[model samples]
Target: MSKEQGRTWDTSLFKRVFSFTKPYGGLLAIILTIITVLAILGPLRIALIDHMVHHFIEAKDLAGLRTFALIIVGILLGETFLNFATTYLSQKLGQSIVKDLRNQLFSHITKLRLKFFDKNPIGMLVTRAVSDMETVAQIFSQGFLSIIGDILVLVFALTMMFVINWQLAFIVLIPIPLLIIATNIFKKAIKKSFQDVRKEVSALNTFVQERITGMALVKVFGRSKREAKTFSEINNRHKKANIRSIWAYSIFFPVVEILSGLSLGLLILYTLSRVDDPGVNFGELAGQLTAFIMFINMIYRPIRMLADKFNTLQMGLVGAERVFKILDTDELIPNTGKVIKHDFKGGLSFKNVWFAYNNEDYVLKNLNFEVEAGETVAFVGATGAGKTSIINLLGRFYEFQKGSIEIDGEDIRDIELNLLRDNISVVLQDVFLYSGSIYDNVTLGNPEISKEQVVEAAKLVGAHEFIDRLPDGYDFNVKERGGLLSVGQRQLIAFIRAYVYQPKILILDEATSSIDSESEMLIQNAIDKLTKGRTSIVIAHRLSTIKNANKIIVLEKGEIIEMGSHAELLQQEDGAYRKLYETQFDGHEV
Candidate 1:
């Protein structure tokens, strides 16, 4: 478990959380009314019992006793109904708020720039969207409104106690100060425990998610035991944190019971002392004593629950603090451009562009390049030579720190974000396919592309043969991350997917590097057909792959070293592209 921070109640944070309840204001009002009624009913029930003892039971009037019994039962039934309504309505309100909050959080996450995702772990985000959201819901179902009802019960119970017998009320409250001190200690200790538990939960989730996703790597490296040891350590810390909270509850609840027992003992002792008084009316005194006993229970129960409820509220506020932090983040890419264009000529240019994933560490420094409409340009470089970064910039996944990128003579930043991306299709080396039918993966749930369109695209890309051979044809499930398909097959599906979109610009980033020679030939043929009239950018490690490119640009250390047709670059014996080609081809004829 991590070291716990000092937790203090922020009233402003509480108010912010309360704001989610605005949409269900009417239901909340009804719940509040029900709570108020419930509070009064507890005290009123005790008074009625006292009345029956004094008037009916003492007089032995059977008819009066029956009538009073029926009235008391009726009140109990009404109270029960009110309690049920409060529970149902409060939970309904909580779930509704959670639905809205989850939707907003997910939508906000989608709008955040790719840079934000680079810094945040997916598992931690899952915790925020899943577990922490449920915690916020409890703010309504079990924390906020419930605390209010407990307080009201306390207030009403104390008032009735004073009304019935002020002296006895004072005697019973004598142990309350000690209870308060104990409760304060428990609350502080438990708050720290809750914080520690929450942290460990996130850590555990992150560890498990990462390990499971990379389980193949772990097994191949024979690190299962080592990973298990690490997981055990994290799980143990989570268990220890929970145990500490449980220990606090164990000590605190017994302490509450002891204090309550002490109050009852004092009440009994005081009544016994007054029994011998000559002027005391024994029946009336008996009735008051009975009412006082019931009132003591009413006061102490909510008092005990108040401590727990207050902690629930505190936990919820802590969750809200974390959630609101995400909501308040200004990392979203501003899509303020009003220009929406469907037809793109795909003339692209980069003018003195500078970019860095981190501050001042330029990955693409002062880069300048241009590709006229319908021309296919290739970027040939070693790993980290800023090949992928250019694609990311074109799609506006990450904003460049300086200079401008334009599409068809207009700054891409001024073009509507969706429209800008919609006109481009990229086939990455690592194709990600959702767990669904092949057809679904191809269309990406786009209703505009019909089954006939998907089939046609698959055929055009030569992916139709393999897809047709599958047991379910186009309906075959790829399982998680396309695990059911070979790397080449997944790449073919990616080609089909891109082709179906009919984008104005196409990008192939090492798309054929991992595939077999046969698959590469198929993909190459598909690429030739797809890039016919569209402006295309190709990033490749295989020199032969881009031999036919209209322009081949060689990059080293974020700076372009050479640019020309493959044959022209080959003519320069010492040029970067020529040297790279020689290394790959190794004296083989071009």
Candidate 2:
């Protein structure tokens, strides 16, 4: 179900898959060599049966018969051991390749631009990262090396059969061409069916993951029945897609079985017809016929399994196409700059910046502003006035269409993205806390920051009191998104996190909007300490909170209509900031 382009069964795709396996070349070489050996040894057991009949059974040599029985047992043991090794090694190799691939997918996705995530669903990405990867692994575990063994066995079986008795070999292989043709047709049909199955699987996973995540919302909206119906529809489509693959397999295997039976019948008929011929030895007839049956199975078994193997290959290729599409995507923000030093003094400027999520509809149009080092600038605006967008641009989370942003006199594009982001800290209105201990959440797994440092930062942000009151103190686990914590508590934790980082440029995007008056006062005190000597950008909805800011930039339609100190902006009779201040902080002296 995604409109993502798929790869055809092409050599290029195989090359990409094989590149991952190249590191395990020694192991693969051993597997392939053992497979070739197995192919050669496969016919030897049939030859042993022939030898037993001609040299031991008919000749009435009990000693020779005992020896032949022991040799057969020995061959079976050897084959079993080798077979186990091949399977074990193949699976191990596939798992290793998948591990590397999954890591790469995760890393690449993390590096991709925010727009890619905006366009793609998280559930669909989960399918690609997890389920699709398993299918890709199956290409090696069940399809690649096994196919090689099957093909080699077929080749060796045919060669040995022809060498033993050309006439019988020809008769036994009479239906092979038809089997090959049928398999080819089946390959094409099954490939398309497999693609359909994979698509449905992705759709099903996407539906389930999204529904589960939004289960609470569904219940609140009283649309549980509607969602269930939608889920059932998706589930049924997945089932139907699987059944389509099953149907192809069902039609194909029986046809292969019939062809195999026909080959055996032809061999028997041809051998029986040759009984009166002078060149035919009646003594070896039984032995030769037994060997011919083994040869037929060896050749036809691979032919039968080719359809299944081809199906596996197709599923993997489709999965690979989806994965490679992400890997190959050029939508990543190019990190061409090498500057790693982030000791910024925090003078920032946006020079005639134009931005749009989609190119046609501009959100921020020709916006220009400047903030001096250690200045706290508060942006006041209506909801869509591009306030939060400014923080996003400053952090380089998304790319702007036109113009440039400079930090500490260096163009943002020239400054390394990580370095630029490292010097800037953003505390959004909605704080996201990972599932970890309070200490870990504050430090964010940074080994450089000690527990003492975490405690000190929490105290500085006024988070230490509540954190210390908890059973585990700083070690208290903040469960999913800090669900156990109150909104004020989470905001305090976020303040602690930002404080611990000690970024040169601090951004509070309505950071205290959800806090109660008590918590807001504490946060306001923390903000004073936090923004003492840093470039701080504040986007606030509560006009009273930003009255003492060094500068207030009031935005409307992506451009500044008023820019001055809180008192100076209030003096303008028709200013937007004055109207906003009057409406929100009315009768309260600045």
Candidate 3:
């Protein structure tokens, strides 16, 4: 068993996992049958050796020996067939389970609210989805099945031994209890070592991921040596964990092998002595001893295999517990309703909303504003002025407390999540690109988009010029968050993505800050066309970006301090907008 963590695997977890196997039930049954046949054949093959040596060898008849040889050959062939069947079916089932787990974990993770991610490390979450799931799958395939097989076969072997010679059986059984105790002790030690190793594995994965993701930052700061040292420390930790596990295994295997070997030797010696007590023929006694030794050896494999499986299952359970911890986290923002499909007529209103991240530290206080359909509104403020928080609430990324935000006359929360989100889109401050062709990256999952539309949108934001210059143009792969593209180019493509969606409510949260001045001019034109007849909210510090807005609202600590046209706000000699204009925009044009 894994040490008590905050979460542990409920036995019911297995039932939940097996629920995926309903479709593969027929294959599972066949696999189990093969395992049973293999188990039976293993002991029977040992028993056959006794019959052959005792009866046929003494007759000095070549025909009889040939008959036994044929039986042995047939058993070998049958075992081989059964082994092949088990391996293939087990692989199929394991892969199926892993695929289901990966998809389920991914879907569930995406459904979870942002707060869950805020508290949990992404490295740990990723470990659960990929590495941990693999571990559980191995347990389900080999650990789970072989444990049952080992127990059943061990029982059968003992029953046969007792029937053959009860006294000799007692000698072999003496070491069985000690072996069980040793296995348990080693398992505990191994579990601790594995838990440490598993944690280190997650740490290494996280470090590597973050390092690669932020390679530019590291290179800019010339922190390569420091980063390499940090990685070496985690790598050493992982190595130490593995070494400890190897030690436990080293100790455990030798003990099991010695005990099983001792049992075999003792049985052979005792059986030879038994010949003097009865009319047991010397050949028959030798045959029984040989059979007993072979059976002991055969049985040791299952015993050792079971112990190994148990160790692996424990590690997998630890992983599952970690995964379930993420799955079980309270969805900080719950969307409760069928997906609504009502299109917004581009109206937006906030009713005296009071909001906070947690229980305290209110970011937004009693505040209100409304924008008419097809209106463009701009929000300008310094960092931590609650500009982005409002955007997040508008998109339902987080829920606001103490107020109602309405879209098209209905409360946003009352609208079905799908319906609400479908009517709205946000081009966030951070531009993220996936590893795919530029066209694929631009269109995202919107399959209805045509190549012409993708190119049109790209052209709208000046992304097409450089894209066409690339070796494969729109077909060029982005390669991991557009690492191959300039940041300004990536931002332009992201803008095009937001425009292509043609949302009723569009929120640009500092979406164009990374773009060059020339591209910004192109994006401004694209924004004009895109925001036509839609509710558009722009958050920006650059005066150049918001000059065309119908109203510019200046926020101070989540409260609207000034709301009016750009000209009116600029005219306010003592307004917060003028102060921001002086400090941030300075000589830049409005």
lDDT to native, each model: 0.90, 0.86, 0.81
Q: Write the per-residue lDDT of candidate 3 for residues 367-434, one digit (tens) a residue.
A: 69999999999998888889988988887888788889988788888887777877787877678899
Top TM-score model: 1
- Residue pairs clashing, model 1: none
Residue 19 lDDT, candidate 3, scale 0-100:
75
By TM-score, how accurate is candidate 2? 0.94
In order of appearance, the predictions have TM-scores of 0.97, 0.94, 0.95
94-154 per-residue lDDT for model 2 (tens digits):
8999999999999999999888988998888998999889988988899888898898988
lDDT tens string, model 1, 1-590?
Answer: 33225646788988888888898899889999999999999899888888888888888989998998898999999999999999999899888998898898999999899999899999999999888888888888999899899999999888988898899899999999999999889988888888889889999999999999999999999999999999999999999999999999999999999999999999999999999999987777788889889888888888888778788878878887888888988897779777885468989999999999899999999989899999999999989999999999999999899999999888889999999888999999999999999999999999999999999988998989999999999999999999999999999999899988989999999999998999889998998888999999999999888888999999888989889898999999788887787788896955
Error of 3 at 488 (Å): 2.0
Alpha carbon deviation, residue 303, candidate 3 (Å):
1.9
Return the top candidate by lDDT. 1
